[model samples]
Target: MNFGDRVKEVHREILSTPHGDLPQEFVTEAVWRGEAAYFLGWAIQLFDKPHPSTFTDPGALTGVLQLLQPDANELVPSARLRAHPEIDDYSALCLLIRHLLQLQEMQAGGRDSLERAYQSRLAKLGLSPASNRLEPGAADAVISSTAKDSRGLYVVRSLAAEWLLGEEE
Candidate 1:
């Protein structure tokens, strides 16, 4: 099946499940595939548009990205999305979405606000963002580190920022 069909099937399954009882494994799989499809769709849409001077509203983009961010472990592979490149691209897109969202939040209300928004967004996705944090000392270290460790996330974020700022040629 194509991406849209797969997403539809997964959405149907998720909707059919009883509230507060969705299987974690199923949710993870669904989220992985769904995020891939969502970003792929956005990529296509952005491609079709004529190059604009700048993104009309970065906040809107941040909101969409926040909503699309998946709440699953990156190591977990989705059965439906078996291609390595596809998975990598999807994960990178997710990371960029997160990075941009954090940036926007930080600009608005400093580090504390960013942390709160990040936790709140994850909670809305039914994921525990707190669990991902390291110990207080380690957390500070990680937070202070540059974003260069993940090549995929960095590359995606760079390209996205360029596009958002209308620097794309």
Candidate 2:
């Protein structure tokens, strides 16, 4: 079924169990759990069959990424990260997804890697980590650093700087 139908199904299931009959804490936990599950399912579907628009339009891709962020952020609490012992790999996942999309658009004999594409794009826009000059490997370094952690990935500070500088315009 489509996303709307799935959302409606979840809503029906949640409402079917009367909230008043459950403890307040239990109800809250259940709702959050259900929402997380729904978002996870949706994200899986997107990864399995990514819409064409997501690849063609930057805004659409951004929206899909944004939709997944809330669930990803809430799914694992920071305190529990120590007990469960998992690193936040969301940035790596996003980079992989973006690379997959870019690869799909490349010619069969194209030799460019995703890193190359990122570097080329940044160079074409004259964006460096410091914004003053493009050192030989600066783009690669910046993108690599950003992909290494969630904090760098979340705001995409360098990418935002490029956009604010009107490079895309």
Best by TM-score: 1
TM-score of 2: 0.22
User: What digit string (tens of lDDT, one per residue) describes model 2 on residues 1-169?
Assistant: 1233344554445444544475564554444343333323333343222221111222333344333334434333321211111111222233333444456568866746656776665456544232232235433444445433233222232233334334442
Model 1 Cα lDDT, one tens digit per residue, 19-83? 34768868654443333333433443422221111222323332443322342222123323234
Q: TM-scores of all models?
A: 0.25, 0.22
Q: What is residue 60's positional error in candidate 2, in angstroms?
A: 31
Give candidate 2's total backbone clashes.
0
> Which residue pairs come into collision in candidate 1?
none
Full-model lDDT for every candidate: 0.39, 0.37
Consecutive 10-residue window with the lowest summed lDDT within model 2: 79-88
